[model samples]
Target: MDRTVEHYERIAATYNEHWTYNPDYVRGFSHAITDALRLTASDAIADIGCGTGLYTRRLYEDVRPTRPILCVDPVRAMLDQIPASPGLQPLLAEAEDLASGRVALPDGGPLDAILLKESIHHMPDRRATFDGLAGLLSGHGRVLIVMLPKSIQHPLFAEAHERFEQLQPDPTEIADMVAAAGLRSSVSYRTFHAAVERERYVHMLESRYMSVLGEFSEDELRAGIDQFRHSYRDTPLLRFDDHFAFVKGWVPAR
Candidate 1:
């Protein structure tokens, strides 16, 4: 398994803990996508790289309660956390496998939507992956790729922000990739706030809650945490601007 998958498998148990700090962040994103797609209870959806079913559960509960949804991820441990439900199906697979027909829709039909919620950055090849996934969409199916651009005006911390900027794909590049895959594409932005106590935020940082933070050495992680604590010493209720780029692509019915 790749380092990314291994890292997530190791942290699968605590992955859902993110909701505690920013309860509405993921749900807000889900609502935006569902609204943009005009999804209904009958629409078939897939949540790619759905770590611990964070957005998966929210999409089911808040948006499409009876929709057939597949939660796809490479790590079994992560998939193991998803609660069993009639409409929710958890599959162990990677993004590249989707295009190969290795990953199938829950109802054995074409999908109406595929969601890559903060998960595209982890894919090995963005262009090829998008091209492959586009083929799996139904005549009117859509794909929504959500990410945070490096140019975000504000992030949780300077170091983490810089790392995100370096790792995330450019919005234009993502749009081009989707368009190249023969789907009509557009990009939009959304902003949410991650509210947490300063002490809790520091603890999350120290634990390397995000995969991006895993790149830092122990010393670097410690230094970053110290800087954050020092910077927000006076702010008890710490709120950070969480900016996201939503890239939507769709093929018109034949």
Candidate 2:
């Protein structure tokens, strides 16, 4: 987890640029997330592992504009990239730390929702972390874990897909973890399509848009790009099959 934080810190400056090529795609995903969670303007939410505040900002704009959100991440550089706003509070903390109370939320009464977006895989202990987060919720609070399951195919880079499969947890496993944390949980699936120009997609691959790409060697990356160019030479746009799972755990009202 420490090394993962370092990697994100190094790439924090340009991280949001990875998704800039498709604004509608991002907006759609955010809308789906907001709908799935049934978030309201009065709900107090926390976006854990919110890198560069991409989705965090979207949540504010598309869902709960007036609500204050706590954006937490282990990387200070990533947190720094989040724009300064009265509604968005940046906290320097890891998932496990937040769960264990090593890091505390800023004097808010209680959180109505805690969102773990593409971040659960990075935590050291999944069950313990979930248990900790469960402790922080308000009586009716829910913990939402948004993730890309291992079953989905990565369209651009094979190496990144392989690494994702190696790290991603199964949806059932996450649900069980939530249940073990003493919360009743359910899982739902959604598909988001991101259409990017072939050239831009290749550029994102070459720039190592995902942390998984960092594991590939320079030669391997070049080879992957060559393979992509050959495979999509005739296709001007690449449509990514972005399949995701929303695992929700409810904290019963006291």
**What are the TM-scores, per candidate, against the unseen true structure?**
0.92, 0.93
Top-scoring candidate (lDDT): 2
Error of model 2, residue 41, in angstroms: 2.3
* Local distance difference test, candidate 1: 0.80
Q: In candidate 1, how many Å is residue 197 off? A: 0.7
Candidate 2 achieves a global lDDT of: 0.83
Would you list the C-alpha lDDT of every candidate in the order shown?
A: 0.80, 0.83
Instruction: Identify the runs in model 1 with alpha carbons over 4 angstroms from their true place.
Output: 65-67, 153-155
- Candidate 1 per-residue lDDT, tens place, 21-105, comes to 5666777867887876667787788888888887778788866556658899899999999998876889888989887677665
Please give, for residues 1-254, the per-residue lDDT of candidate 2 as tens digits.
Answer: 56687678778888888897788878888888788777888888999999888988999987654667889988999999998988899989888888888887787448888889998888778887888788888888888899878766556556666777887789889988998888888999988887788888787887777777777789998998888788889989877678899999997656
